[model samples]
Target chain A: MDRLLNIDRRIIFIFVLLGVAIPLLIDIHLPIKPTPTVRAVYDEIERVSIEDPDRPVLVSFSYGASTMPEMEPMTRSILHHLFSRGRKVVGICLWPEAVGLAQPIMDELAAEFGMKYGTDYAFLGYKPGAQAVVLNLGQSMAGTFPFDTAGTPVGDLPILAKVQNLKDFSFVFDFAAGDSMEFWWIPYGQEKHRFPFAGGCTAVMAPDLYPFLQSRQLVGLLGGLAGAAEYEALIGVSGSATSGMEPQSVTHVIIILFILLGNTVYFTTRRRGGKA
Target chain B: MTRDSYVFVGFLALFALVNTILVANGALSLDWDGLGVIVAAGCTLALYSFLYKDNPLFKFAEHVYVGVAAAYVFGITWYNSLYGEIIVSYFDIGEKGANGGGHNPWVLLFPTLLGLLMLTRFSRKFSWLSRISFAFVVGVGAGLTIPRYLSSFLLGQLEPSLAPLTLSWAGLNLFLVLVGVITVLIYFFFSVEHTGVVGHASRLGIWFLMVSFGASFGYTIMARLSLLIGRISFLMDDWLHLM
Candidate 1:
């Protein structure tokens, strides 16, 4: 029992690697249903599509590659819906590394939907300050991001011609890893820009954002891969989120089992010694 | 002066001064760009402020940053929520015009009352009054999250296991999901006694968790690696092309 407790962590690491790898190599995909949280996000998009296809939606990629596995699917699916519906999009990044992370996904989707760079969608690249940038954007989009990711001026982009501030957008969606919540929700979300908003956050951070969601501060939320999978299911597209569900499910169950086992052994051994 | 301390302080002063100038000027020229360079330099110098131990300059800068953030938040909330949504939507005083009939003056009461309740925290005698506001916030938050939590965590999680069980490729996926689910559940079964059957099941669960964790870790590593790769790609593809 002691030996099991003190086993080298490397052995555990190897076991974890196999658990995740086997699923990946086998390309296991499982059926997923859209949860209400995910459905809310989907429904919001649908509402936007039906209400106003011309209204530009602002998307802030506030996370970098480290969070891509969980966030990318949501981002991609949202983009697909927006583009397919002929809604304009304006992409911005708070994280320095997010600019690059968004490039391929945006380009691929843009190409698929025949979206003209400046006309249908634009990437604003990364700004140095986060909250300040959001505030500035709320006040004036051109001031915060004078140039698009391609170095084209916002003034030059026909799609952005009507967009002077964050209020011009019909909705805002934030895919965030950290600190962006206060920046987006408290400052821009609560005060300066009153656009409908949604968020996709890492699992560790999801619980904290629930209050905001409940208050109707956020119209919807994508909590993690689970949230992402649900979003994918809602959109009727099975992408990375769908593929990730198998491994995520497997791992979650495994963790639960181990926790049970560890507690059981400790309690049982102590009981034999009459410690209980 | 210590080498690192001197460098850091110098950079911090430089960056702050430059950025201040650039923001004021609203344009970047070769000469003006030096302001940004200086600000960057000052920030770089300030990086070593931690090494010299806590001091007034570091503390001041840190506090300034916090103050700026607070001010920014206040500004945003005033403009976006209080002004835009409440003032503009209800009162129709701002540029957007009234959303509804503008007759719901009573709607203003809810937010005002809630805000006032929050102010009670400052008074020791009335601190208990703050609970009302806190309760409202928490209650609304709870209400919102309960449904979301169920959808995001429970239904979303369980939905993937509904795959058809067959003897061929479809069955394989079902088998994986079943095994994964059972083992992972075992891993998390903290309340159980791990003696005979339970122990074996728990061990298998541990294996499953480790693998999942490992895969997650590997994915994280890959994601980070991609960032580095992206930076290199930029330097090569974008910057060097100009050179």
Candidate 2:
């Protein structure tokens, strides 16, 4: 009981390592059910595809590389959905590191879908002043980002020809790893313009967003990796997030078992009036 | 400098040599992308080396990561914000009249002066000059944010919670949400003593808060596990090509 109570931290680390690494090596196809929150994002995108096909959609990368593990899967799944639906996407980076990290994923998906840069998509890249940029975009996207990442004027881009301001977009989605969704997109952009807005955030930031969702400020939200996996399942094209869920589930079970074991050991030791 | 330092240097040299030989033998492609994967895998392993014990490799990777991040931010700020937005647009440096000539250069002067004034914080005597810029920023930020917060966050939330309750599944869910909101607010309302009905309500509020925190904590664990799965997947698929 004492040995179980005071297990070496490194031994627990090894168990966790095996828990995560082993399932990844083996092929374990876990079922991913789309939650209503995630389904709302998908349904909104579909509605935009049917209702406002010509207008471009704004996808903001409000995350950096550290969050690439969680954020990238959401970005990839959303981009895949947008491109597969023949929706024109306008990519912008609210975070500096997103210019390097997130833009490649967009470009890769664009290539996969055989979409052209100037017409099917345009990446505006990063500019400082996140909330100010959101407000500026509400006014004039062309003025805030006069030129796309490739130095082509927004005027030259066919996809962005009608997209002079935030209201021009059919739908807006922000994959945020920070408070960008809550602080910038919600009040500065979404509320001011009254656009159909959704967000994807890291799991740590997920609970805080439920209030906004409840208020209908957010049309939908993809919260963390499970959310990404659910979106992938909905699209019928499983990607990294889907593949990642198996290991994630396996490790979670291990953690739960450890918690149970720890509690049992603690109670057993304390029943005899011993220090835990 | 020390035995462990020599051992570390030796390991790095061996790693480099192996990679070079792999490239020479066409096992690793002679391209930037391929080399980048190797470097990324190296960095990932170096950082993960900390799990065993604190080591020089982890510290080396940590320093390199910080340095690279700082440099990247500096480069992006200069190129994206300073050069593109300010220098090119305000001064019309690039394709003369590229910005469509509608923006007035003089319009930027006041903000530019305030931005420059913020630099005076480095000086001891003139540090007070920065206060004017700070005050303007805070005043404008508060003025812009206050009304938006009230209307969108506070009122928007309140209106939904107050929706007329009825005998439907959605109404039941809304009722629970309304109750949760009230009790949670009551939990934070500290002026009233928790002696009577308020005590039970506050206790129920604690349960609601705990459930929310437990959900948040579960999500936090899932987020961390996802990161671990990501690195492991990268090693398995990208580095080893086993998947």
Candidate 3:
């Protein structure tokens, strides 16, 4: 009985491996309902009519490859919705490693939408000085980013011709991983420039933002993969996040079972040990 | 070599063989980039192997990831932020050199000079000069951030906390949050001795903290497991031809 509690951690990992793998192979479609948090973001973007290039969406890809599994799907779905709505997008990355990561998605989606590079979408790649960068961008977009990622002067882009600063945009959506959203963007971009703010973050960071959400400082919040899946459902477009739901659900159940069983056995044996 | 060492080498050979087969089966054409899929799959397996036990393969993969990340960031920072924003604006080289005249913005020199001063931190004797740049950055940051934080985090949050509690769903939730906030604040008040109702409220504060912590723990677990599911899906759908 005690030996059962002492098996190698690898044995437990094998259980999780099977738990995640089997459901993924089965390809089950779990029903998902979008909460008001997800709905708020969708409705806000939906209000932007087609060919509304003047009020672009500022998407700060403040995350990297480590968060790609979760954030990438959100990025894709959001970018698709925005571009398809004929709304222009200006993407900037605070994380340097994310600059390369954003390239493929931006290229493929731009091609998919038949969107021109400068006029429809502008990817002003990563910069340092997180708070300072956000502050400068709030003041002047071209001042902070003279050239887009491809070295084309940003002012020359027909899409960004009138877009001077963060205030030109209708909304600011930061797909944040770290303190960039709450600390930098909220202060420098939203409060100073006074634009509506929406953000998606890792599940761990979601609870931390409840205070902000409750205050209505954050208009929308996408929590995690669950959030990504919810966003995918809201759009009626089943993407990678939708495909990942069954595996995620099953794995969570498996982990809960392990925790309960492990606790039951431990307490049972400990009482027996105390008596003996 | 020892028998165990030979077995390790044999396992590596078999792993490489399997990945090669998987890549070839998945490849669309004979393009050199086809090798990329094989490398990616191999690295994924190598990193996942750490779940079983740490080994040389995991170490190699970890080292490669770190090196590549550093080099990639170095290139990105140089071209994207440093050269593009500061250098390009200062020189006006592209427009001025070609067109014989361009708008030369002198405002960019402040940042250019500050950046140069920051570089002086590398020199032992002139390390103090960097403090000017450091002080400027910090002063500007604190000056900008304090008012914003107070308004957004403090006053904004206080609005919900201080709202009247009534007999409704949202009101009940608000009442509970208000109680939690007051108790949590009371718990942190070390200046007051916890002897009476204060002690009881502080005890309730512990429960609130525990509930908050439990929810965060569950969410963290979900985040980690989702990462695992993500990799597994990639292995199944993208790497192998199984899905």
Candidate 4:
């Protein structure tokens, strides 16, 4: 009972490592239920695909390489879904590290769909001031990101020819690891530009965003890899998140069981009138 | 040289030699970016080594990551933002403009001056000039934030919280949300005495807050575990070809 009180953290780490690694080595597919929150994101994109396929979907890559594990799958899957559906994509990164991680993904996915770079998809690249860029975007895209990641001027790119501001686009999806959504996009971009806003954040940030979701300010939320997995399901494409879901589910169940066992052991020892 | 230092240098030399040989042989397969796989595997293993204890390898990997990030950012700032946006646009060297007409060099002069003023912070005497630029930033930020904050956080949230609660399941959920909001607000209200029902509500508020905290903690665990899983997958799939 006392050992359960303060088990060595390394032991837990080893367990977690095995918990994650075993599922990767062996193939396992887990059932997933796409909640209404994830459905909203899919439905919004589907709506655009049906109504106006050429409308450039604005994707703010607000995450960095450090969060690539959670964010990369979401980024790749969403791009796959959008490009496969014949929706034009425009991307920007607030986090500088996102450049190295996201650009290659956009390239691979676009190539898979036989999408042209300057015409079908564009990477606006990294910007310095986040909120300032968001505010400036509400006014003008060319003014905010004058040059795409390739250093070709916006005027030279055909994808951004009709994209002058936020309103010209169809949907807003912010793949964020930080407060880019709360402080910048939610306040300035969505409020002023009036685009349907959706977000994919690290799981930790998801619980804090309930207020925004409840207020209907955010049309949908992708909470984490779980969210990414759900999005993959909605698109009917099994990507990295889907492959990784079983391990994640197993790891979570292990942690929950540990908690319950620990609690139970402590109480049972106390009931026996012994030190725990 | 010390024996330990000799061992360390020999280890590194051997590792580099093997990596190059493997890459040359295309053992990792050129399609996987063989050189990249070796380097990534080395860095990933080096980083994971710190879980056992701090070592020179982990420090080397950490520094390499930071250096690469810094160099990447500097290149982007020069090419994408500053040079492409400013120098080319101001001098009519680049084609992008908000309205398609070329930008006036005169229009950029004041902004260019203010930007230069911000650089004066490094000098002893001229640092006072940087205050003006800082003040301008702070003043504009304050002005813009007031209305946005009022409209988004205050008015927007308040309106939704005040929605009428009915008897349906949806309504019951809304009712629970409203009660949680009110009780939480009451818990923070220090103006009134909290001896009886107010204390009870405050305790309930604490329970609700605890539940929220617990949910956040659970999510945090999931987030961290996912990062671990991601790295392991990279190692197994991309580097070692174990998957």
Candidate 5:
């Protein structure tokens, strides 16, 4: 019993690695149904595009590379939707690491849509303070982002020419891990900026944001890999999230089996002792 | 004072001084409107005060942050409501009213009342009065979330678990989902005694939970590592062109 209780953590680590890696290698693209949360995010993006194709949508890449696996699919799908509808986009990174991470994705997607970088979209790069940046955006975007990510003056960009504040954007989608939620939602979403908001957050952090979602502070939420898969399904793109579902499914099953086996061993040993 | 405390304070002072100088010299520029580098430097120093000890400096900075946040929020609310809702929606500014209304000024009453009710939290005698506001907020929140949660969490989770049992690879997925659900459930079966069949199941569930937790932890590590890798990549590829 003690042996079972104190099994080497390395053994468990190996089991997990195989469990996640094997399914990933298999590349199983499981069909996913869009949950209401995922659908809500999709519907919001669609609505914004349909309602005002000319107005730019602000997307805050508030997560760093660490949360990319969970957040990237939603970000890609949302951007795909926005660009498909011919809406301009302004991407900002609150996390220092996010500016670099966002550049490739934006460039790739913009290329797909044949969209000009400055005219159709722009990356505002990273800012130091989160809440302050959000508040400044609400007040004056030009003042907050004087230049684009590449250091081009904001005035030179046609897409940002008329965008004076948060009100200029049709809606805001915050693809974040957790740091900027209180900053973006409480101060900006709930208080200053009345723009409809949606969020993409890691699963661990999803439940905490439910209150904000419930209060209508957020229009939709994409929670973790499951949410990401659903978003991919909605966009008709089988991306990393869709592929990841197989591993997620396998690992979840493996954990359950181990639990059952451990319990079985415990009961059988106890029963033998009773018979003795 | 401890030697470590003094060292920390000295380092923080140096950092603050450098930050202030950089901002003043336009080395670190921002896109927004504010007291420029002075406020940034002060806030940075204030936040860093925690490293030395939880003292008056940290408290002052924390309070200032709250105050500035509140002020910014007030400015935004003024702009949104006064401009977006009032001018655009009620007064039909720029012919952009969604509902085409110029005289439905009564719509502002609900928000006004709710805002007023929230202020009651400041008073002891009428603290209970805040429940009215709370009730309204909670009621609406519940109405919005319950239905969405049902579809998003319950139905969405169950749908994937209902896959058909087969002998092929697809069957493996179904098997995994079934076992995962059952075992994960057992892990959470805390109220029941760990005896007989229940004990067996519970033991299995614990392993499942541990492994799942381990996998999650591993992935979290990967994510963090990715952040580090990304920063390095930037420093190389974008900054110095070494990559």
Candidate 6:
């Protein structure tokens, strides 16, 4: 018991490493059920695809490489669903670092679906100013981003020919690692235009946006890799998020066990009249 | 050379040998994409070295990351914002004629001046000039944000809680929300003494706050673990091809 209480933190780190690594080496194929929030997002996107197929969907990649693990999967899963349903996608990035990240993923998925650029999709890339950019986009997307990431004129893109502004989009989803979703998009773009909006964010940032979810300011939210896994399951595609679930679940269980052990030790020590 | 330098040299030699073997074994190609993967994996491992102990490899990787991030930001800012919005828009640098697309060339002067004024903060004597820029920014920001915030965050969130009550599960959830909101508000109300009902409500508020915090903390753990899972997946699938 004393040894357990005084175990080296490095040993615990090893446990966590093994927890993640071993599961990746051996697939667990854990079942993932879509949460209500994530389901809402899926349903909304489905509705948009069915009812307003002509209107382009706005997909904002508001995260960078650091958060790619959690966010990229969600973006991929969403894009898969959209492209498979023959929906047009317009990608934008609020974060400058995210500019490079969006194009590759969008291009790869577009290729998989045999979707042509400028017709099936367009990427506007990043522009400075968070709130100002959102407001400008509300007014005019082509004006804000005159040229797409590839230096092609937005006017030439067949997908965006009829799109004038934010209101033109049938659905908008922001996969954010930062405050761009709640801080900029919700207040500036969604509230004013009253378009259907959903969000995907780092799990840590998820709790902060629950109020927005409750208010229906956001239609649905995908929080972290778990949310991504749920989205992938709903789409019936076993992407990286699905593969990552095993490792993630194993690591979480290890962490919970450690937490329980630590608390039990501390309480027992306190009851024994010893310093915890 | 120092001991750490010797270790680094040894590590580099070992890495080269491993790479050669990988190439010879047809595990990796001598292409740009393959080279990129190797470099990325190297950097990831070097950064993760810190978990064992802070070493020169970790520092080197950390410094490289910071430098790359700073350079990327600088380059993006120059090309995207400063160059595109200012120079291109004003001087008609691109294919679009005077004033580029549709922006009023004269209307941009005020913002350009404000931006230039912001640079005055670098000068000790001229620092006061930056205040004009700051003042305008603050004024404009406040005017734009306050009403939007009131309408969206405050009223929008408040409306759901004030929805008509019923005897269903959703109504029970709404009731809990109402209780949570009122009690939490009472907890922060310092004007009233915690005598009887207020004390109980305040105590309940503390519970609600703790539960919320606990959920947040749990999500935080999940988030961190997900990142670890991601890194491990990269190493296995991309680098080692073990998956």
- What TM-score number comes out for model 4? 0.91
The candidate scoring highest on TM-score is 6
Give per-residue CA lDDT, model 3, range B126-219, as digits (tens): 9899999999988988898788888767877899799888899989999999999999999999999987999999999999999999999999
In candidate 2, how many Å is residue B175 off? 1.7
Model 2 clash pairs are none
Worst 10 residues of 4 chain A by lDDT: A146-155
Model number 5 iRMSD: 12.5
Model 3 over residues A109-184: C-alpha lDDT tens digits?
9889998888788898888988888988888787677777877777677878888898888888998878787888
Please say which candidate is ahead in DockQ: 3 or 6: 6
- Candidate 4 per-residue C-alpha lDDT over A149-191 given as tens digits, one digit per residue, 9 for 90 to 100: 7667777788888888999898989999998888899888887
TM-score of 6: 0.95
Prediction-by-prediction clash tally: 43, 0, 0, 0, 12, 0
Range of the 10 consecutive residues with the lowest summed lDDT in candidate 3 chain B: B96-105
The runs of at least 3 residues in candidate 6 whose Cα sits more than 4 Å from the true structure, single-residue gaps closed, are: A1-3, B1-14, B97-102
| Candidate 3 Cα RMSD after full superposition onto the native fold (Å) | 2.6
The count of residue-pair clashes in candidate 2 stands at: 0
Native contacts recovered, each model: 0.00, 0.60, 0.65, 0.65, 0.01, 0.66
Summarize candidate 5's per-residue lDDT along B22-101 as a digit string, tens digits: 55666555444324434554555566456445766679889988897667545534443344344544554543342432
Error of 1 at B61 (Å): 34
Instruction: Write the residue-wise lDDT of candidate 6 on A1-276 in tens digits.
Output: 577788888999999999999988886787899999999999998999889989999998888888888998998899999999999999988898888787898999999999999999988778888888999999998778877765566877899889899999999999899998899999999989999999899998999999988888899999999999999999998988898889888888898899999999989988898886
**Global lDDT of each candidate:** 0.66, 0.87, 0.81, 0.85, 0.68, 0.88
CAPRI class of candidate 2: medium
Q: Per-residue error at B180 for model 5, in Å?
A: 28
lDDT of 2 by residue, A175-227 (tens): 99999999899889888899999999999999989989878999999999999
Compose the digit string of candidate 1's lDDT tens values, residues B57-102.
6676667666865675565445434553455446555334343222
Report how closely model 2 matches the true complex, as a DockQ value.
0.61
True contacts kept of 3: 0.65
lDDT of residue A48 for candidate 1:
87
lDDT of 3 at A232: 89
DockQ list for all candidates? 0.02, 0.61, 0.58, 0.58, 0.03, 0.66
On the 0 to 100 scale, the lDDT of residue A173 in model 4 is: 93
